[model samples]
Target: MASEPGFLPRDGLDRLIEALRRDGREVIGPRVRDGAIVYAPIAAAADLPAGVRDAQSPGAYALHAVSPDERLFAWANGPQALKPLVFVPHELLWSSRNDGADGPQFTAAEPAARPTAVIGVRACDLAALALQDRHFLREPYPDPAYRARRDALFLVAVHCTHQADTCFCASTGDGPEAESGFDLALHEIDDGFIVAAGSDAGAAVLAGLDLAAADQARMDEARAGVEAAAAAQSRSLPSRDLRPTLLERLESPQWDAVAERCLSCGNCTAVCPTCFCNAEVNEATIDGRENGHYRQWDSCFTSGHSYLHGIVIRSETRARYRQWLTHKLAHWHDQYGRSGCVGCGRCISWCPVGIDLTAEVAALAGEGTA
Candidate 1:
């Protein structure tokens, strides 16, 4: 986390975790759990998923151990990202109680969130976080709860040294190497990590580690790994803006083909970091004196999402799939000035049926329609 890049030896990483905990930040990082790299509370460098390489493809993900190595942060990404840290999956909005005889009193529920530092944040997630910020922190009515959690978050990115077959962040201009939005960033090499600070807080943390300046050879080693990761990626979305391509092909038969295979289980939206749809619920007490109002994550594929006045506008999976793709690649540009997809490929890997969007896009555009 230094202004000039520094070498953080493997053991030094342990101290870095300590430094964050000392700063009263909850240290969250990648951990090997439940057969996937998931974000959990990490106390030391050993908590990282070491020597574990992940294989990712359409509808498949597996983590294999290649031990006798000291490398940590060797995997691309897991099913988790920075989304849940700030934009909570479930949250309480407010509650109303009739303690008085005259009128019921309403109280706004403030979220209790501690200062948190997350490690191993990838470029795609960072890009997704920016889009989330634009949506949640927009003018006129900013989300108070999301803003509070976001402000207390500290990001530590890891430059990708490995690319999954499903990854296309390189072509999306979001990854393989992070361009911005992290407090600190790291490039993993044989000896250790080459660390750099992108913010004052990151610099302060680096100052406590007593790291040495990264030499040219070590720096180049880390840089080369990242470059190679980019070169190895095979999947990429269409180069042009997908908005025009998709909007013009509203009647494309590809939608029906994809829908036939799609389960409409909402796995894609659930894993997508940029999806922000939520459903509100009000539960009234038995006596009717109090009511609990809550909001939780929802997906566009859900029938309730399109249900209005006893009608489901997008009742069919074909319509729902088209809506999701169009909004993610087209309408999002109108709202956030960019595409919603960060090209992390979570949708592809997590989809139970292996519906690759890249191939679907090409089909709809008539580039390679079968």
Candidate 2:
């Protein structure tokens, strides 16, 4: 069911923060970190990256100062996504201890989950979160840890009124505006924010703010803001029906061509919002008195990802690149009923060599091969 929309004044931002914190939820939002906008725990409205914008391009990102009146979410996105909140980068599965007389004992090391409110979540990342829910929660053997975190998650999604050169969420059907799956969807406007609740909990939060009711004109401005961003995008995926084309082009020359420039550094997967590959390892002390089994993030681009008893199937960079692209664009739909790439363009912006996957796919599909 849909909840009513309201208008929150710029100063009223603190009221929302206090409301969530009062509910014992840790508020996470965007902030400047290491020269870029990254998500972190925020204590108050002042912690948000106000008047800060980002300039992004293939293999480059720079932060610039904007006037205070500029939108708070004037930047596109950062390397961090909603993935880390649900699927932790590193998780302890269990631990073994050597008892003095009892021989050995094993104990499960489950992660402690806190009720979390994530502010300033982008539309593209909202889609990624839903996709990950399908992979980790809806599956037959649902991930308990992911479920715990997901259940406690309260999404405060923001519409994209500003886009980077690399973003293509418009083409991917992910967003410039969110349709669902958020507790609250916000559209930042001059002097305030247009906010709508997606669930009862969000409505409860909104009720506490005592915000003014949103009129048609305010709603129109919010819609126009999101639409303007969609039209401004300069990059897009080649097609909506890209699966068959990508599946057939697995043996194309483009893979080898791109592989030559690829460093196999795993930057694409590392920054990808939808990529969820992981590897399990056992960490033990030097004396072997205690050992912990953990699952950590892994990438398909790595040479050892396909390693077997004595041989690696994808030893060559070309093969590994092909596997990664094919799995991401084509095979993922068969497994998850959706494309793995959300068109967030993190792969394009963060690639060390500026290798653009959309360009590669377009070339392989015989459209603008140049």
Candidate 3:
């Protein structure tokens, strides 16, 4: 791909935000909230986290201050993602009522309002969302709800200068730098930012912004910085041929050992960006005259998730746990041409049991069983 011109400085960002606001679009980005960087609506430049960083660990998170005074883009990934802002956790599909003599009347529920731009999206999250795009929006049977949310929103992906111990985007070939699927990509370079357009919508936003043309030297320097940060990743998985190994070791003994510590809480799948399994439930009136059906997020770890004619496929916690991990790292490639995991490590961070997928995979592979 040819290199595109970059943004000038902080002034260009202001102009872009103003443009979005003028269009009556809600401009959401990273903002400091109770010491953590979170995605929320921004009214001005001052709302962004100027110079602060977050401390992340498995089941622990905290925020701290950074030195640079004018640097507005000096924060890491937040606990919250752009998923809920787009795909609502719960929604009323439809409802009906009875008028006695007139019989039953149905009312169609309106879809979620289209959101505008989502700024400061980390590269890993963007890659995970790309995987979801293939599953929900680009598949043979497309989800209208997901399609509407995906098509209407704008994306602003940010390069991660620092990686947490839990992060393994490098292992998955997903992150540390924004590659594509972004409307605009921002890399923090000193006191300013190096912005690149990734789509036509991004170009349009850039055209209206007050950014100066990025020279060859500046662009090259910015690209080099991004590459260096990505190269400096401290954690990674040896997953080049993981799928075949995992497939061969489906009945491996390593699974039983790991399952001993697993609570089967489904926290891993809930926090995972690409795990999109859902289940439908019908709500009916006491008289059974009116009812509404709805679908909600589901997890393979849950016993009901694998329910087949009232009998669960994997009744044991060990089997259910093994099924999820193996499918994510192994079989997902056969189905989607890519591993289901983006190596974001949210699963590691949020799991109450502190079960590490990387450690499990490494142990299995080392035993010559995976």
Candidate 4:
């Protein structure tokens, strides 16, 4: 049976947090840290960045205070996403030590994931998480650590009432309002949130919250806010299926144009939620004592990424940038059943140089259809 929708008042949010924690789940939520909103451990709703909003554009982001406001998730987004929670940036796969008489002994890092509940997830991130699942949990060799962490996750999604200029999830058919993949979804309004459950666990949590049944007036208001946020976005991809057209434009001069300003800093791929490239590293002690093997997040923009047989394939910034764009917009469809971009616009806002992919797509896509 479908769970009835309820209005979770501002005070009820605290109770909801308490309920999740009481259920033996550690809560992770958005909070202000180091001049940006970041996902961090939280004990209560008070830990959230209440009344804090953000303004985002190409290569710029700023936080502003909305005084006398009770809104906790009034901001569009921060630098961080749900990627770090499941796909750890740096993880030790295993470590080895030298034994004097015996051979080398290796100790694998045990998957020590605990039940975790994340609040204030946006629709774009939910879509990105789905892609991450597709990449990590594929057949033939699923990532054990990623699978363990993913299994213990409980998602609490929130509709984006406030969107930044860099947002374009509507164009990608991803956001403003979350529809699926979340355990509990929140439709935020001025006074509170209109909440619904997408899973049995979510229904259990909702039932314990003691929230009132959502009324027609507030429900209408919540829908309106989400619609306004979607409509307010000015950026968009040329099409949802940019596979053929982007691939056809591989030799286009637009690559040179973008490379003129591109920094080759790998920030775009680093911030991208769907780009899952990792590099394995091994360290050995000079005294032949011990060795450790680690894996860390990597990016295509790195010059070493294309290293093979003592030769670099994508040596120039232009080629590397082109590879990123084509793979993200075109090649990913073949590999992952859809374009890799979720239109979160982290690449744009977090870019050291203001290189907007929407603008780049507009430049390259001249009268071409997917």
Candidate 5:
């Protein structure tokens, strides 16, 4: 890492990975997995998906290997989001044990976390992280487990020069370019990468690196590439106050129309980076002497998610589907002062029934126009 924005040759990436490891940080990054890019433990820069790209559409996703000379950051968003890394899908909250004397005693479970440096983070994921910070850190009762994982993370954000057909980050005002919330940011160019530090730790790493200073001409080329990516996005939300509009139409027939096509499989919320719903369960042995309490990710689409007093609220698929869409686009604003959807297109790409929220909202507004 240089003291300032600088040029790093392709091989510098391997050195960076080594530098993080030398600092006792576990490095996690995008790698080819089960025909898709998934974040996993990475040992070296070779673990990155160089010259790989993904084809994504509603109900479909496929990865392809491009030219060997292709840039490392050529792929767009993957099915997995940043939520799983920090929020965690499931965790033991506490365990109850009894000695031979008194009743059961409960011991709180702590988060098992390691200092981690995450590479290949995209702009939309950064936005999602910020929103999650507000919810998990700023809430009335902050989640200690989430806080632990979040505090242990070092983000390495990368600019997206490629756009997927399902992406609409431009409309969400989130991406194609990552502007903040990163320790170090990298912009990939033909010759190499333009790297800049956004924090003191990042600056310290850069100061020890053997890299050349980036010139204005190189910066200009990188800006052009990002702009081209933004323009290439074919999908976008309508330029209007979507929150108020969607709220007003809570009773719209469009909800039923969309529910007809929805599978209620919870794939949208599962892939969503900002969906924070969860449920807690208490499991006990057949003897009923000890109990294990655990928390797991839950989806609003489940029939039992809203169960209360021997009856289920939002019993119909239409109501559950409405809860998901309205909460994502409308109610999230009231709760977080921002939209939950980062426009990364994971929801669209992973949906089994190909239900696009952008299209559903368009239908509510009348001619189904973009």
Candidate 6:
């Protein structure tokens, strides 16, 4: 049987944080910085972005003080998605040193266990993590490093009560609420939090905190509030079946139009939480006496991504752009059972040209031009 849901008053959040820390878990959460909310290592509960809202745009983000401190969690997503913590940006797979007599000696660092709790994770990012799990952890050949971090961490998902102009989670059916793949889910109910456990671990946390049980009426109200926020989304993708539609429109001349303005700077892939493609390089001393190999994040926009024998599959800017879009919206489903995008809009918000992906998909679906 499922455990009963619990509620935690907003004032008790500090106690909960301290308890998690006492239990030896490193707690990280959002904090107000220069002019935006960023995920940083937090100690005191006061460091969190309490009573502040963030305004986001492509290549821009700003922080604003709220009136009356109505909803402390009323904020849009952040510029950085929580991907690097799991899929390291760079790592050394193995290193070798010369033991003068022995030809070469190699040692590899085993993946270490991480006991971490990330609070204030947005709904879109939660969905992105689920998508990444399918690619890196649930695959036949799982990534040992990613699996270690994912298994040891606890997720605290937050419902987005506010939406940005670039947000489109509704169209993708991924967010405005914590649907799945979270241990604990929280809804901002005025100054307090309507907390619910999504898994056994979440229930254990709630039990440890000894929080009060949330009544059915409060749960209903919280659900309604989440639905209203989802309905208030200002952006949406077209309703066409993205996989078939995008594959059919691969040569429809729209690729060149988008590529013309796109700098091909690879910002989209970098900000994307589910892009797991990477490349490996081996380095050695000038005399080739010692050597080591390292893995680094790679993107489809790179010229060397498709290199084979002296030929590149996508040499032109337009071809590379088309390949990226098609793979994300079309081929990804065929390869992985789910779309590569999580509707986080991180790609759109980080793009230097303000290239909105929702608009691009709508244009490709023949709804209208971006």
TM-scores, all models, native as reference: 0.97, 0.97, 0.89, 0.97, 0.96, 0.93
What stretches of model 6 exceed 4 Å from their correct place? 67-70, 283-289
Off by over 4 Å in 4: 367-370
* lDDT by residue for model 5 (218-255), tens: 89989998999999998887742478778889999888
Per-residue lDDT tens digits for candidate 3, residues 82-174, read 666655566667788776899888987666565588878988889888878777776577877777778778888888876766888877888
lDDT of 4 by residue, 240-339 (tens): 9998788888999889989999999999988898989889998789987798898899999997899999999999999999999999889888989999
Candidate 2 lDDT tens digits, 263-339: 99999999999999899999998998899999999998886789899899898889888888888888888888878
Number of the candidate with higher TM-score, 3 or 5: 5
Q: How accurate is candidate 4 locally (lDDT)?
A: 0.91
For this target, which candidate reaches the highest lDDT against the unseen true structure? 4
Error of 3 at 303 (Å): 1.9
The TM-score, computed over Cα atoms with residue i paired to residue i, of candidate 1 is 0.97
Candidate 3 local distance difference test against the native: 0.77
Clashes in candidate 3: how many?
0
Q: Write the per-residue lDDT of candidate 6 for residues 222-242, one digit (tens) a residue.
A: 888888878877788775248
Candidate 4's displacement at residue 82, Å, is: 0.5
Candidate 3 TM-score to native: 0.89
Instruction: Enumerate residue pairs that collide in model 5.
Output: 1-206, 2-206
Query: Per-residue CA lDDT of candidate 1, range 1-370, in tens?
Result: 3378889887678887888899899999998889999999998887788889999989999999999465788788888888998888888899999977779999999767799999999999999999999999999999999999999999999999888989999878999898899988998888888889999999998877878999999988988998999999998887636888999999988999999999999999989989988899998999999998998999999999999999999999999999999999999989888889999999999999999988898898877752
Candidate 2 lowest-lDDT run of ten = 65-74
What does each candidate score in C-alpha RMSD?
1.5, 1.2, 2.8, 1.8, 1.8, 2.1
Which is the better candidate, 2 or 3, if ranked by lDDT? Answer: 2
Off by over 4 Å in 1: none
